[model samples]
Target: MGRRLRRAGRRAPAVAANADGRLEVFALAPGGSALHHRWQEAPGGAWAAAWQPFGTAAGGAPRVVRDGSGRLTVAAPAPSGVAVFHRRQTVPSGGWGEWQHLFGWSDAAPALAPSADGRLEAFALSPGGARLVHRWYADPAGTWAAAREFGEPGAPLAATPTAAADATGRIHVFAVTADGRIRTRVQERPSGGSGPWNAFGERLVAPLPAGTPAC
Candidate 1:
């Protein structure tokens, strides 16, 4: 039978498995006051006794992804919504570092996906929701590339984006347009660069609320 894992806030939790294969969950506290975390005591085993505070003053649900080196990193928007912050495990399946400012002026929480080359890439909606912007780690040293606009110039996104890496290592991003249509873009070559935005070819009966998962 299923058992209660832990009490969580209204925002949906984000989960990822560590290099050692243990599953970890990140959730926002009620009212997005803080980001909380818990994990299996052992790979696929019992849960941690208590939820630990990962970070405070989270603006939205947390997004987690593993770097090429297998270390897990998490990102979340600041409570004021003007910027995003991130923290990374000092080593794979080890302790985490303090939160540090990652980027700014996001309308919602950012989406994270590992690139084919092992770098972690982040995507966020511009303040007006008219464009998507992204940046990537340049190396394991943690150098970040300058943020750049993504998607077509005239096509405005209506909601936050979500991303995932395919088996072949290409990263695909999906977003909802104002008219309830889904659109997507992908990397031309894994971590090489991006391809043109394309219609996903399905219109929803109604617009998906902001932050809805696209894929």
Candidate 2:
């Protein structure tokens, strides 16, 4: 069953759930200048708050994730590069902290996920889209590690990259290759180092549709 739909702008929305179970949604405004966020106060509760605007002059769609403590961090394409922004609030509807820009650079959108250990990691395509680069917030708000590039010298990715962390503490990143197949790389927990880049060797999925944004 589906509820009757309401219309919005073209940019896709990103969502996250807090530890307390509040639902938060973020989307790019029609003009692409800022992000609009809305959230619920409780389970099955009526969505409260209007779409509040922040981060003027943003680019692409925003990516959001929650830390172990349920704080929110967002990354979106920006003029200089991708900018990571953070917003922290208490439960039962609380005031949000000031937005802070972290760091990143990519011609395409960035991806973010919390590792099994609860550290925040961000993945983005290089400025030229020739390489995949990443950085992590060891403390999720403290100093960030130096950027690292992964994958072999030649085979380039053809679309925006994505990442996920499983219960076993393994973080997997996936992308579509120029040859129209999918490739994956893993970074095991604790040590936080990646294994070899493995092309699935089979065409697991078709290439991204045309006009899809580059990863």
Candidate 3:
């Protein structure tokens, strides 16, 4: 029942949704120029991106999460580093209020997820390659709290961390291991922190058929 986050950005475009039922898209421009992103109220809502150039050329991956009230939280890669973005306004027909930069730099791609009631909780690797960090905000600019870590760093983590939350707002995180094993971690709210990255499952990996990364 932990939160969920996905990888989005120029290198790997990602799409996320909140409990409020909105979707956000993340992508990159040509030649690593900028990180492009967008969000929609419904299926056909217009999408927008920060698209500013700056930070790690290689991305940590991007993801999005939504709260119960209809707010969306996005964890995306930027030139300066990995950060969090939140959706605050409602578009009359097919628009969204501007995305607000909520949380600052993260050591890795963020894991975002929404609670059953629309509250949002976000997670990411710490500034150093040590602890997994979690944070929650009532809205775009609400009080921010320091969340507990769910896992400890054992080996260098590769790939973007993916997260998911259940009906009760419990969170689960999975890491695609260097050796291709699926390592998983979990946590609970208010107290229970991250667990160890234990081998739990396997992903369906297939040989690439020679396709370029999506833009």
Candidate 4:
């Protein structure tokens, strides 16, 4: 069986592998007051002795993604749900910079995915969960583009969305709809326009339990 770590968290932890291959974990503190982090001392090795208080994260679990340059960036929503904050490693597998506003108006946790060309893209549900919106870097390690709605304007999501890049480098986003159906949208081209959202797997027999993270 896997051994338990020392600290507790308000939400399930988010994890990612560093450029050096060490495993890092980020978690939200009880009451969603802050974010804490721990990491493997070495690749596939024992975890750090204590959780380090990283930064503020009003609520919801944090999300981490490695940009094309190999730097890790983490983002979380603010308490009011009107903004998101993020921090990035100064260098690949190195120390992180101060937390900075990332832009938002998110009603739920945010999701991130790295583009084929090395740019980073962020996704979140609009204030009422009535639309999915996203923004992406203009270029690898560059400024961000304006946020825009994703998918058809009338469609709504029941929970936070999740995103990942496929082997071919196209990014795909997945979410659960109000009716308990899974839907997905894919990049029509690497680091380019997105295709329309489409139904994914067969409808779930029962809606996922509240707080369950949908793919």
Compare candidates 2 and 4 on lDDT and give the better one. 4
Ranking by TM-score: 1, 4, 2, 3
lDDT (10s digit) by residue, model 2, range 71-178: 677667774554444445533234566665555556455677777767777777765456777778767453467778765678776666788886677888888876
List ranges where model 3 is wrong by over 4 Å: 1-10, 16-24, 35-61, 82-108, 126-129, 138-142, 153-155, 167-169, 177-180, 188-198, 201-215
Pairs of colliding residues, candidate 1: none
lDDT, candidates in the order shown: 0.80, 0.66, 0.49, 0.78
Could you give the candidate ranking by lDDT, starting with the highest? 1, 4, 2, 3
lDDT of 1 by residue, 1-215 (tens): 01232344346789999999999998877767677889998998999988887888777778888988899999888888788889999999999988887878873668888898889998888665776789999897666888888856877667778898888899999887877777888888778788888888866735555544433
Q: After superposition, how far is residue 8 of candidate 4 from its true place, in Å?
A: 5.0
Q: Model 4: which residue pairs collide?
A: none
Q: Give model 2's TM-score versus the native structure.
A: 0.82
* Candidate number with the higher TM-score (3 or 4): 4
Error of 4 at 194 (Å): 0.9
Compared with the true structure, what per-residue lDDT tens digits does model 4 show for residues 15-82? 99999999899877766777788999999899998888888646567788889989899988787777
Q: Candidate 4, after superposition: displacement of residue 181 in Å?
A: 2.0
